[model samples]
Target: MTSLLLVEDDAVIRTSVSLALERYGYHVTTADDGLSGLEAAQTGGHDLLLLDVMLPSLDGISLCRKIRETSQVPILMMSARGDGLDVVAGLEGGADDYVVKPVDLPVLVARIRSLLRRTTIAQPQPETGQVGATLAFGELSVDTGSLEVRRAGQRLELSPTELRLLLEFAAHPGIVLERATLLRTVWDYGWDGDSRVVDLCVQRLRKKVGAERIETVRGFGYRLNTT
Candidate 1:
């Protein structure tokens, strides 16, 4: 059974979401405050974390950052406000995805499933049929079998989402990948999905892979620079 750590301060939301997730066959451990949530997250037993943006003692963004410092456990953030700044802050703070509150249980479950799937197939196989195949883009190297990425020979600490996004770009170097394509291929989202996830993920990937390696093609999409 998949286990989850849910951190939310609202008693009503805490109870309802926990029960709903339980019905979906997840083992949930709940924490009502940020400090407790942080403590539980640090213990490292859960497969994923579900966090509410507002909490006592520490905000969800801070907790997300703290968790990211040592772990790459999939994180999904829930916020009452869908404001751009709030969404950006959560993503930049290390969350893999976010959902607006008045939470739709079905949509939330789909997001959870998507995130979980990424973890299972985090290191996708290369097309060469070679074990330990490594693909190079300039100074950046990705060992698909080993699930490792090194830039200029230095290993980069990337979240699973970042790693998968980088691999997608690496596979089709110099070709423009539309956000819609990326949404389906990388994130498993359909047409109605938010494009901001792709943009924010690209921003994070660029910071680690070097900004010059990826080019934004205005009004089109983005491409990985092979040179």
Candidate 2:
């Protein structure tokens, strides 16, 4: 059974979601506020975290940022407000994924499953290409096999999502990958409306990997600067 930490201020939500997830065979630990959630998260042993945006003491975004500082555990942010800014903030804060409030159990479970798969699935080496080769672009380098990224010989810490996005770009070199394609390939979502995840992820990736390394193509999409 997958272990999960659920942090929500609303008692009703906490209980209902906890019960629902338990039925699905997930071992869940609940917290009513961000401070406690942060404490539980720091203790570790959780496969994933379902964090609510609004909470007493500390907010979800801050808690998410705190967790990211120390751990790469998959975080799924939940918010009652479907505001674009909230979603962007959560993702920017290091959440692996986000789901709006009134979450459908099936959808939430699917998201959880997808995140687990991404973290646990081993990438098989491709035969045609230099599967385990490290690609270098200017001062930046990406090791495919180890998934390590470095700039000017300094190692850079990246989340699983960011690393995957970087690898996808490195694989194609100068190719301009469409947002829809990136959504499907990186996020595992087919909905065209889910492009924000791609955009936010790209923005985060640019911040870490350098903005100049990824060129925005105005209306088209984005391309990696190989030279």
Q: Count the backbone clashes (under 3 Å) in each candidate.
A: 0, 0
All-Cα superposition RMSD per candidate:
2.1, 2.8
The TM-scores of all predictions, comma-separated, are 0.95, 0.91
lDDT, residue 154, candidate 2: 93
Q: Specify the highest-lDDT model's number.
A: 1
Report every candidate's CA lDDT: 0.90, 0.86
lDDT of 1 by residue, 167-224 (tens): 8898898999999999888887855677888899899899999999999999989999
Q: Which ten residues in a row have the lowest lDDT in candidate 2?
A: 121-130
What's model 1's lDDT at 159? 88
Question: Which residue pairs collide, candidate 2?
Answer: none
